[model samples]
Target chain A: MATKRAQKMEETRAKLIRAAREAFASKGYAAASMDELTAEAGLTRGALYHNFGGKQGLMQAVVDQIDQEMVERMLVAQARAASRWEGLLEEGVAYIEMALEPEVQRIMLLDGPAVLGDPSQWPNQNACLLRTTQTIQALIDEGTVKPVDAEAAARLINGAALNAALWIAAADEPHAVLPKAVEAFRQLATGLLQTEG
Target chain B: MATKRAQKMEETRAKLIRAAREAFASKGYAAASMDELTAEAGLTRGALYHNFGGKQGLMQAVVDQIDQEMVERMLVAQARAASRWEGLLEEGVAYIEMALEPEVQRIMLLDGPAVLGDPSQWPNQNACLLRTTQTIQALIDEGTVKPVDAEAAARLINGAALNAALWIAAADEPHAVLPKAVEAFRQLATGLLQTEG
Candidate 1:
């Protein structure tokens, strides 16, 4: 009975977060009202206050949740690949795919920066950059990539990947962007890492 | 005598655009006011009206001017390079460098998207994309780059470049980002294009 109640509570919390994400993404942080958010979540204002403290707290939670989800997705994509170059390529493609998902697009690219004010200071950016740098270092150590500075390479790749996501999100035809970007990324990766043709 | 007068007027117009660019870049579009802009330019409201029709018109002119400057700079960088690969690398570096510049950072990355509504419909985006596509196609046709879909590659590169610029603009240490990004770009580009080690 306790377990079932816990699960239900968790689901409710998730529902609230999802509703808040949509509200913030569409209206921006400054413009979105707490009343509207609670109504959308189908929860009472008191419940929201008890759960999240306030709007800033809710926004932080949304960012944290999205960042965790992105990391997990990236790890899965990297692990599934056969070669280091292939892994990197798949990772890039996976990022674009994730960005194209409506919820992810709305929360991560559009609303996250818009609400956060200064994107460089966002916790998600630092976490993402650290993860990316570590990945690049691993690729270099494995001899899958060139002996260039891994930190620098990671920053560039992360920047590129993030940009690709944002562009895909902003475009009218988001679906069409990934294949082309993936192809270029594959070629770019192979050229940078492989010893010879 | 008339030609001299016309030249003087053009110089004044350029001064107004430069001042507006600085204002828009630093203050953002919504926060920046015409009174402040004129003050920054050392001109009165009467002069401002004579030069640009109003704030919206001035913003549009600023966008147009920046767009033209970026295109010209890119072309110049491409022209100065000794090889196609080098040119591409230089172009990437130049782009990051330009992004670090205070005015370019402010106008292009921040104010452009913030005030411009949807970028897809922006005439500047269309022209820029078209030019980029043509450039990539030419390089591919010349056997400078590997045989691939030029349009797709162009979009990917352009997207990456734009993102790098945006990141740098937002970063606390804007100067440090491009060197790393450009190095990574060099590796990526080399991997994509070069036929031999």
Candidate 2:
């Protein structure tokens, strides 16, 4: 039950976000031109300002959108896994691979933190971090993981995975680097698994 | 062996670097003004440009100075510990605590990466990362750590420690957050310990 004006407003906002994402992904946040973004969306500077309150607001919206998509992708990866531990591991690897994507790598991982500040302080909420903590908690409860602090474990693991992705992205031979990063991550995660009563 | 002129040139560079570090630490790289920095150093703007090409160049110099000092501090912490593994852990925790310092957190951790692009690609060299890799390799060689990939493990553990420090820096009560981060790091590192043949 939306009015015609409301529907048009929503469309304009979404259009601007998509346009801004493409700009920010390719050129980065600091270098991306507001004019180029507005033109790319087939809108004017007024439209961007009116819809987003300015460039910073637009970047926040872009971050929130990308963050939600990343969380959804992780959840799907987790569901596809055969075991809870496998699910956690699979979700992590998926996150690493997802971070390898140029758009996500630039917009979400690098530029996002630099432009918006710390991930924990982000206003949109870190759904991906939440999902990670939940999976670790489940593993601890099932005795699959050691009795470690779940949130702490999640942050450490997430940090490691993020850096691994950055390594792959920065490497001249990402293909060669991918397997090494994955194996290293596996070893780290496996160390957290419970070996005895 | 050195001329008086050469000695004066070295002093000028050091003075400018110190002035710029103070400016960048308080106001960040983008906001820091080159004119003010040179004036504060009691050096001419020409001296600033001659010694360091520009603002970006000055920040790079500051980053190198801080990075070297950080490695030195970590080495001292390691030497104080009884065992190599304990030394590595102690160095990591010391690193986390050092990162809590406003100057280190702002100049090195936050603005350093933001201005210089990825830490892996910084032109000054990541001496801290190299030290961590060397320590891990030594531990592996001594059979203190498992025979895992050394560089990979170093990158993962470094990433975890850096994130934990950032977490503390962002916390409202860093004192409360510090213990949780350290314990979580211990749990993660303990997982990496060699448990069996």
Candidate 3:
């Protein structure tokens, strides 16, 4: 199904995405120049335009790539946990920890939301939300979580986790602040557990 | 202590801050022009730099002003509620409601964070968090809430409310989405109540 020309196009797109990631990681979206990005990819301006509409397009492509990587990393962390509930907690905590990484912080959490608007509105950005939602739904089905809306819980938890991450990343002593974030997250999450039900 | 010159300088500062707020609220931080902003304030470029440093500084001032307004609005909402718990809930929900306003959405949430970085890091932005933290601390002292770390709880709640507001603001049907966000927020906050503890 793949012709040589199509294959070449695919390779070019991938190269541009890689280059854009480095640019975003270093100079951020605003400062990352178009000429610099194109040159970094070992491609011409025409190739850049043909693949992505322009700077914003390439920036979004870079974001999607980073988002996918973040999700994969989260899934890996989730998989390592021993129980579903623990796994879910691990996932939330992991989300906060991931925010500590410079690339994820600079690209996904900061520049991505700033440039692209709310991440929830993005089609591809839903992977993390959907995953969190499904986990909550499964917990509810098992009567572990209370009889609350799964999607609602997911949104609240995800929102809290994200904010905690932002707080920790910007904290003067991140190592000192992290445990506090996790403990508070666990306590808030407890509100929806099956105790009342 | 009450010199006319000092009073005039203060007025000039307030006027410039007001003008900057309108510029940022209308055009966002990046697109707002320095020349346009100073002219709108009926002042000169020298005044802007002399008072606020530059565009970034002026924008931070705008954000600080908006942050103060938002916190004052929250305090007023809290005062209106029947109980401390009710007041706290009102304050949280009101925060979500505030996100619906375009000015708050544009300047306080989106551009404010995008330009000034994490609002939590700002000197004056802590009023909201401090207010929430104090409320949580009072509730915990009285056993209205669990034994969770007060500051942690505040950060998590603030984060959730912020994210929920952003979600609702960008939703296709904000009215419909508002209920979902509030209901979800209620459930998450309830998880930390004394009953659960």
Candidate 4:
């Protein structure tokens, strides 16, 4: 049994988030306004404050939602692959795909760093990096990758992959940029791994 | 003896660029105001218009300044190094150092993507990538590195290096990040270039 007040509150929060995403995506984080966001949501300042503490809170919520969606998608891709290399390839491709997504790309890569206080402390970045490092560690343990510093390698690869994504996101023709980036990544990955002779 | 109008125009254009850099660095591209920019430059709207077409033109000027600085620094480092590996390492380190500089990092990596109409048409990115490819091609021709797709390899390495710069730029304690990223880049570069004995 859901209370009417609680249901209404949840609905208001959801609407605020949707509106915030649209505003942030279109206007970017720095240019977006609280008034505009509230107007888009068709909510009042009272409703906004009652839901999110402030603009920063609204931005954080948006980042968290996008991060969760990204992590879920990566996990699914990782699960579907036949081998570690294949899994990593699929994960890389999936990441590039996520970067091409308009709303997700805007929220996580573009606006996230600008709005979030410190990128090192950014919840989404840290989580994604950790996940990437763990996956690379698993590959190393499985004898698929060379015995190197998994954390460092993960950081390098993740950094490169993210840059590729950002490039595609900023490009005029994202489709063309993505395939070229993915191919370069695949070649780099092949060169990196230690395959049995 | 320069004409009065020409000299005044040069000064006004330089002032506008400086002001625009500060504004874009601080408030970001979308958030920065044209009115505020003119005020900061100590110039009138007419002066701004006469110098640069508008805010977008001013931003382009700022980007051009940053691009020139980056290319010049890399060229100097490459000239000083004794070997191709040394040149590449110095160039990588120089890039990381440049990324630490206050306005350079923001204007180039952060706001450049945000404000610039389309990244593919960004002259700086294209020029830098081509220059790096030429460097890589030279190394390959000298038998200093394995022969591969020079342009693609350059893009991958450049993309990785740029993202490393972006990561450092986005960090709270940039000093702490630079060493780790540089070490990672060093290893990646060594792994990339070491020939089979």
Candidate 5:
């Protein structure tokens, strides 16, 4: 349905993003060289600029790609859980666990927030937030979760998971830190659950 | 007894910190000019460099001062509470409330983390974390809180509070968003409580 020129432009954009992601994940945003990434993609600096504005723009695109992948993985984790509540908890834990991966830790967790303003304000994060908020509302309706504001609960829950991942990512011994973070995350999420008094 | 030279140096350091704080609070870290700050402080660039290394160093010093003050204020709020549990909740709410202040929001919540890396790794936060861990341990020992890793719980709780402050700081209508954040925080903290059978 598209012209050859338009299709080529799309290919160029994907190539640039793929190249940038590898460079960023390997050497970090600040340290990665733009010239090298463009060369790796078989493109020019002008192409990079025209396609992404600059390094920051490219970083955002790379982060968005990784973040979108993270959401999909989390959704799959949620779907695999035995119940909705379990799914929510599983998703949060999966997010924390994903920090163990070098790519996720380097790009998405550490460099992403520092390069971009706030994770909450990211366009990709909005979809994740919307889904989480809807789940919280449904849980509240089912009397599984408390009657607290659904969006508020979702933000706090997501904030907790996000910080935990950041913690794991920055730790010297991430493997050693993983269990404690996962456990604390589980305990924190329980606060939203409705207790049979 | 201190020498007159040392006394003068101390005064100079204090002057630079004060000047830098006002500039950073108003113009943010990136836009705030070091030249203007030093000029306003009645000091030279050499003096700022000698006292705090440079602009980033000065920002760190300013953040440390503000963060220490925040901790003291939160402690005061906790001490005013009727019970330890109430104090804990009050302290978190007080933290979120402080984000409304322009000075605190700009310096500590926004620019601080972006420039200085994670807040959990900050030296000033170490003191807060220590106190929080101790409180969580005490509450668990007294059967007022669930049996969870004290440091882990403290990190998650502090993380939630920190992110909530960041959220408030960046929100368009922070005042309207304040109540939801505080209430959700209260609910989250309740997750750590030891419910009666």
Candidate 6:
């Protein structure tokens, strides 16, 4: 039936994404072999072409999947913080820290931007942007953050964090670079805070 | 004479770069025809390969040329400011403003990043980064900026401006988006300033 076919197709898509993610993480996008990935997924090339359109398309899907996971992880980090303002800061810092992970450093930070264009412009990021904007708006309402344009502040905050990660990943010594990046990110973000009377 | 030949070669290189810049600015990197660009320069594809590797190499040269010009313009903006800290702010704002220019938006901001990878990793950016880092160190010494890692602060500030420009360029209403981005940028930068006792 139609329901069974839909479930089967979903399984096929998930399998392809998982295989492609592993290949991309290990070998990188440029060297990642499509034929090998398809075989690893136990699917044919036709299935890959039909589901994801081709290699670049598969890369996009993998990037999206990874990005979604990153966002979820960030949310968890934010939740653990004691205050909303602290949570926002933690979220930004978490993004910078994730750059230390090899899979994240390679796939999301390096290969993703080179292949898929700007992550900010990606459809998946709009969700993250909206969420950040609302959080910033709330901070502004409570006099915790300066009354700058919420969306604008969100964009700059997000941009700063994203670029810091890129800087860390590309650096010769990522571990040494991580603390500097995280500290700078926190300092830069404090500009949004309302000055205490 | 060898001197005359060397001069002629430099002229050929300049002509080729000029033609390619025009082509890239007008039609973008991918759309611009290499044959037409060489013809426009009164050279051959062979000359292009000789001086630069090919289209990509030529693009690098063009990007370098533009990036150098942009840095010079930013310095001029900085020099016009009342103080060094003000100059730094002016330089960042000037960078954002330049995104409004069509050639910058098309060739440098869009096509250049897509083709050449992250601008931060570009060899030419090191010069700019060093200069910015030195300026930041000066600010820290003067107690104008807080005691943070100057290089890290410099990277975050530069990244914020660059990403802001990218955001503005990609927006449907760039003109309307400009003020918001500029304000957010100014607000975000204030975080690094030493808090008044």
> Which digits, one per residue and each the tens of the lDDT, describe model 4 over residues A53-105?
88878889888887777778888998899987788777877887888877766
Q: Whose lDDT is higher: candidate 3's or candidate 5's?
A: 3
* Number of the candidate with higher TM-score, 3 or 4: 3
Clashing residue pairs in all predictions, respectively, total 2, 0, 1, 0, 0, 0
Give the per-residue lDDT digits (tens) of candidate 6, residues B11-53: 9999999999999988877679989999999988999999998
Worst 10 residues of 4 chain B by lDDT: B112-121
lDDT of 2 by residue, B45-97 (tens): 89987878887788899999998899899999999999999988998898899
Q: Write the per-residue lDDT of candidate 3 for residues B132-174, one digit (tens) a residue.
A: 9999999999989888888888889988888888888887888
Per-residue C-alpha lDDT of model 2 across residues A1-197, encoded as one tens digit per residue: 89999999999999999999999989888788999889998998999889889988999999999999999999999999999999988888998999889899888777777667778788866888888899999999989988877877888888888888888888899888888888888877886788786
Q: Highest lDDT: give the candidate number.
A: 2
Candidate 3 residue pairs in backbone clash: A191-B191
Q: In model 1 chain B, where is the ten-residue run with the lowest total lDDT? A: B112-121
Off by over 4 Å in 5: A22-44, B31-33, B40-44
* lDDT scores in order: 0.69, 0.85, 0.84, 0.74, 0.82, 0.84
Q: Evaluate candidate 2 and give its CAPRI docking class based on DockQ.
A: medium
Tens digit of lDDT per residue, candidate 4, span B83-172? 887897788778778877767666776666656633435766555666777888888888776666665566667766776776676667
Weakest 10 consecutive residues of candidate 5 chain A by summed lDDT: A109-118
**Model 3: how far residue B96 lies from native, Å:** 1.0
What would the TM-scores of all predictions be?
Answer: 0.76, 0.93, 0.90, 0.82, 0.89, 0.88
Residue pairs in collision within model 2? none
Which runs in model 4 stand beyond 4 Å of their true positions?
Answer: A1-3, A26-40, A54-56, A139-149, A169-173, A190-197, B26-40, B117-120, B123-126, B137-152, B169-177, B190-197
List the candidate 6 regions with Cα displacement exceeding 4 Å: A1-4, A22-45, A102-107, A110-117, B22-42, B105-117
CAPRI quality level assigned to candidate 6 from its DockQ score: medium
Candidate 3 chain B weakest lDDT stretch, 10 residues = B188-197
* Model 4 native-contact share: 0.22
